[model samples]
Target: MKILIADDDPSSILYLQDMLGEWGYEVEVAVDGNAAAEILRRSDGPLLAILDSMMPGMDGIDVCRGIRQSDTERYVYMIILTSRVESEFIVAAMNAGADDFISKPFNDEEMRVRVRAGRRIVELGEQLRRRASRDALTNIYNRGAIIEILEKELSRQGRSQHAVSILFCDVDNFKAINDTHGHLAGDEVLRVLARRMAATLRPYDSFGRYGGEEMLGVFPDCGLEGALEVAERMRAAVAEAPVKTEFGDIDVTVSIGLATVDKDQTCKLATLLQRADDALYRAKANGKNCITIAH
Candidate 1:
C-alpha cells in the first residue's frame, strides 16, 4: 500500500518515510497542506495518509476536511499527528475526518499498530462495496448498481452534450431451458452467456445483470447506429456459440432492444430504460433471437 506523509517538519517527514519504507510501504511526502490536498485530489492518490496537525497554508485538520468534502468515492485512511494530548485537539481531528491520531513524538510500536488498523478498515470497506455492487450469480453489476450507472451517465450527458446508448437484452426461451434442463444448468448458461457478451462489448461499456435472464449494456458517447451494430454483434455471438454446462452443451439466443440519446436530446433514465424494455418486448413479439431499435 502507498502512504502519504504530510508535514512541514523536514526531520519528522524523513523519519516517518524511512520507517514506513522499511515496513514495505511505498511512501510519498508533502511539505505543506496545499501539496497534500493536491495529491489527495488525484484518482490514483494514496489511500493511507498521515498529516501533521500544524502546517503552513493548510493544517492537517483543513486537509482532512477538504478530503471529506470532496467528490471522491474511495475512502482514505487518515491519521492526524499532534503534539498536545488535549481532548479538544482529538475532538477537532475526529470532526475533520481523521481516522486515527498519533502524538508528535511517535512511538514505533504504536505507529505499527495504528497503521495495521487503518489497512484493515480500508480493506473491509472495499470488500463490502464489492459485495453490494456485484451480482452474485453472473459476477456483473447488480440491478441497483446498473441503474445507478445509467442515471449518472444521463446526468453527465446533460452537461457534456454527448450521445449515450443502452441495450436491454433478454435471453430467448430461457424459462423453457430451465424447465427442461433444471435450474442448476440454467444458472450455468446465464454465467457463461454473461462472460461471452461482456467480451463483445467495448472496454468503456458497462455491462450488467439487470435481472433474471436479462442483461443491460451502457455505451457512452455512442449513437443509434453504433449501438445497433454492437447489439447485432452481441446477438450473433450468443447464437453462434453453445454454452457448455455440466449437464450438456446448451445452445442459447438473445433478443436485444436498443435505445440511444442523441447529443441534442435530453432523456431521463427511467424513460430511456422503458423505451429499451418496450423494444425488447417488440423483439420477442417479432420473434426470438432478433434485435429491435427504439426510434
Candidate 2:
C-alpha cells in the first residue's frame, strides 16, 4: 500500500520515511498539508495517510476534514501525527476524521503496530466495497456499480467526443427456465452465461448483471457498427453453446438492444439506458435471440 506522509518537519519526515520503507511500504512525501490534501484528492493515489498536526498552509486535522468531505470511491485511513498528545487535541483530531493518532518522539515498534492495524482496516474496507459492488451469484458488477460505470463513461465521452455505446441484454424466457427446471438450475444458467458473455467482450469493456436475468454492457469508443458487431457476437456466443449446469445442460439465448452515443448526440446516462431498454423490448417483440439497434 502507498502511504502519504505530510509534515513540515524535515528530521521527522526523513526518519519516518526510512522506517516505513524498511517496513515495505511505498511512501509519498508532502512537505506541507496542502500538498498532502491534493494527493488524497486523486482517485488513484494512496489509501493510507499520516499528516502532521501543525504544518504550513493546512494542519493534519484540516487535511482529515477535507478527506472526510470528499466523495472518493475508496476509503482512506488517516493518522494524525502530533507532537503534543493533549486530550483536547486528540479529541479535535478524532472529530476531524483522523482514524488514529501517533505522538511525536514516536517509538519504532508502536508506529509499526499502528500502521499494521491501519492497513488491515483499509484492506477490509476495500473487501466490503467489492462485495457491495458485485453480484453475489454471478460475481460480476451489480446494477448500481454498472450504472455508475455508464455515467463515468458518458463523462469521459463528453470530454473526448469519442463514441460510446451500451447494450441491454435479457435472457430469453428466463422465467420459463426457472419454471421448467428449478431456481437453482436457473442460477446455474445465469452464472454460465455471465462467464460466456464476459469472454465475448473486450477486456476494457464493462459488463455487469443489471438485476434478475438482464445484463448491461458498456463499449467505449465504439460506434453503431462496432456496437452491433459486439452485440451479435455475444448473442451468438450464448446461443451456440448450451450452458452446462449441475442440473443438466440447458440451451439459453439472449436478446440484445444496443444504443450508441455519437459525437452529435447530447445524451445523459439515463437517456442512453432508456433507449437501449426500448430497443431490447423491440427485439423481444420481433423475436428472441436477436439484436436490435436503437435508432
Candidate 3:
C-alpha cells in the first residue's frame, strides 16, 4: 500500500518512513499539514495518511477536513497521531474525518492492524457508491446517475473548451405497443433498444434510460452535425430491427432530438435535458419516426 506521513517532528516522520518501508509499503512524507494537503490534491496520491495532531499552517484536523471535502476516488485512511487522548479531543478528530487514531509513540503492530481495517472500509464505501449509482433494469446509468455524470463532464469540458452533444430518444408509440402486446414485451423492447443504442455509440459516449420508454445519450467531442448523423443512424436501426415475442414479430420506431453544448447554454444538466426534450416534442410534431435538431 502507498502511505503518506505528515508530522512536524522530523524524527517521527523518519520513524514512520522506515517502519512502513520495511513492511513493503511505498511511503511519502510531508513536513507539515499544508504539504500533506497539496500531496492529497494531486492526481496520484497515497492510500493512507498518518498525520500528527500538531502541525504548522494547518493542523492535522484541518488537513483531514480538506481531504474529506474534495471528491476524490483515492481513499485516504487518516490516522491521527497525538498525545491528547481526552474524550473531546477524540471527538474532534472523528468530527474532522479521522478514519482511525494512534497515540504518540505508536506500536508497530497496532498501527499496521488499524491501516488494514481502514482499507476494508474504503472498499465497502466504493461498492456502495457503485450500487447506488447504477440502474437496476438496464444496468446503464439511471436518470440520477446520468445527470451527475453530465454535470461533471460539462464542468470538465468548460475548462477544456471541448464539444459535447445530448440526444433524447423515445420509443415511438410505446404505450400503444404495451397495451397491445403486454408489458413484458414492452420491457423486452426497452432492453433491446438500450443494448442496440450502447452498441452503436462509442465507448466514451454515455447512455441511460431517462425514464419509461425514453433514453438519454451524451456524446463527448461531438458537434451538432455529428450528433444528428448519430441520431439518424440510431433511429434507422430501431426502425429496421423487429423484436420477436411469443405473440409475433413487433416492429418499432424511435423519435430522436439532438442538442449541442455551447458556452452561452446553461451548464445545468436539467436545462440541457429540457432543451433536448423540447426538440423531441418537435420531432414528434413533425413526424413520428424522425430526428430533430435543437438550435
Candidate 4:
C-alpha cells in the first residue's frame, strides 16, 4: 500500500518512512501540511496518511478538511499524530475526519495496529462504493449512478466541446412474458439482454438499467448514425437469442431511441432523457421492435 507521512521534523519523517518501508509499504514524505495537500492534489494520493497535527501554514486538521471536501479516488485513511492527546484534541481530530489517531513517542505495536485498521476501512469504503454504483441483478450501472454520470458528461461537454449521444431502450412485450411465464422469467430475460448489450458495445459506451423493462446507454463521441448502428446491432442480438429461464426458453426483442447532443441545446439531463423516451415510443408505435432516431 502507498503511505504518505507529513511532518515538519526531518528526523520524525525519516523514522516513520523507514518503519513503514520495513513493513512493505511504499512511503512518500512531505515537509509540512501545505506540502502534503499539494502532493495529494497533484498525484493520486496514498491510501493512508500519517499527519502531524501541528505544522506550518495549513495545519494537519485544515489539510484533512480540504481532502474531505474534494472528490477524488484516493480514500485517505488519516492518522493524526501529535504529542497532545487531550479529549478536545481527539474530538477535533475526529471532526476533521481523521480515521485513526496516534500519540507522539508512539509505540511500534500500537502504530502497526492502527495502520492495519485504517487499511481495513479503506477496503470497506471501496466495496461500498462499488455496490452503490452497480445494479444488483444485471451488474450494470444502476439508474441513480448513470444519471449522475450523465450530468458529469454533460458538464464536460460544456467545458471541453465533446459530443455524446443518448440511447433509451425498452424491452418489447416484457409484460406479456411475465404474464405468460412469470416475473422470474422476465427478470432472467432482462439480465441476459443486459449482458449481451454490454458485450457488444464499445468500452467507452456505458449501459445502465433505467428501471423496470427499460435500459439506457450513453455513447460518448458518437453521433446519430453511429448510435443508430449500435441500436441496430443490439436489436439483432436480442432477437437472435432465446433466453433460458426456469419456465422455458423465452424470445425477447427491444426498441431503441437515439438522440444526439446538439451544440445549441440548453436542456438538462431530464429533458434529454424525455426526448429519448419519446423517440422510443415512436419506435414502439411504428413497429414492436426497431430503432428510431429522434428528429
Worst 10 residues of 1 by lDDT: 195-204
Order of quality (lDDT): 2, 1, 4, 3
| Backbone steric clashes in candidate 2, count | 0
Worst 10 residues of 3 by lDDT: 262-271
The residue-by-residue lDDT of candidate 2 on 118-209, one tens digit each, is 99999999999999999999988999999998998899889889999999999999999999889999999999899888888887798999
lDDT of 2 at 184: 97
Candidates by TM-score, descending order: 1, 2, 4, 3
Instruction: Report the lDDT tens digits of candidate 4 across residue range 143-257.
Output: 9988877887787677766677888999998989999998988889989999988888987788899999899998877777788888888889898979989899988889998
Displacement of residue 156 (Cα, Å) in model 4 is 4.1
**Poorly placed runs, candidate 3 (over 4 Å):** 1-59, 69-77, 81-91, 103-109, 148-164, 172-181, 195-206, 218-254, 264-271, 282-291
Whichever of 2 and 3 has more TM-score, that candidate is 2
Runs off by more than 4 Å, candidate 1? 7-45, 70-73, 199-204, 221-240, 285-291
User: Where does model 4 exceed 4 Å of error?
Assistant: 1-59, 71-76, 81-92, 103-109, 126-136, 199-206, 219-240, 262-265, 285-289
Clashing pairs in 4: none
Worst 10 residues of 2 by lDDT: 263-272
Question: Between candidates 3 and 4, which one is better according to lDDT?
Answer: 4
Q: Whose TM-score is higher: candidate 1's or candidate 3's?
A: 1
Please give the TM-score that candidate 4 achieves against the real structure: 0.71
Evaluate residue 39 in candidate 4 and report its C-alpha lDDT on the 0 to 100 scale.
Answer: 78
Residue range 1-295, candidate 3, lDDT tens digits: 6788998888887888888888778999998899999998775787678899999988989999999999975567798999998999999999989988999777889998887787777668767777787777777778887877778888877888777899899999999999999998888888777877777887678888888989989988777877877887788778876988776778999999888896444456777888899999999999789988886
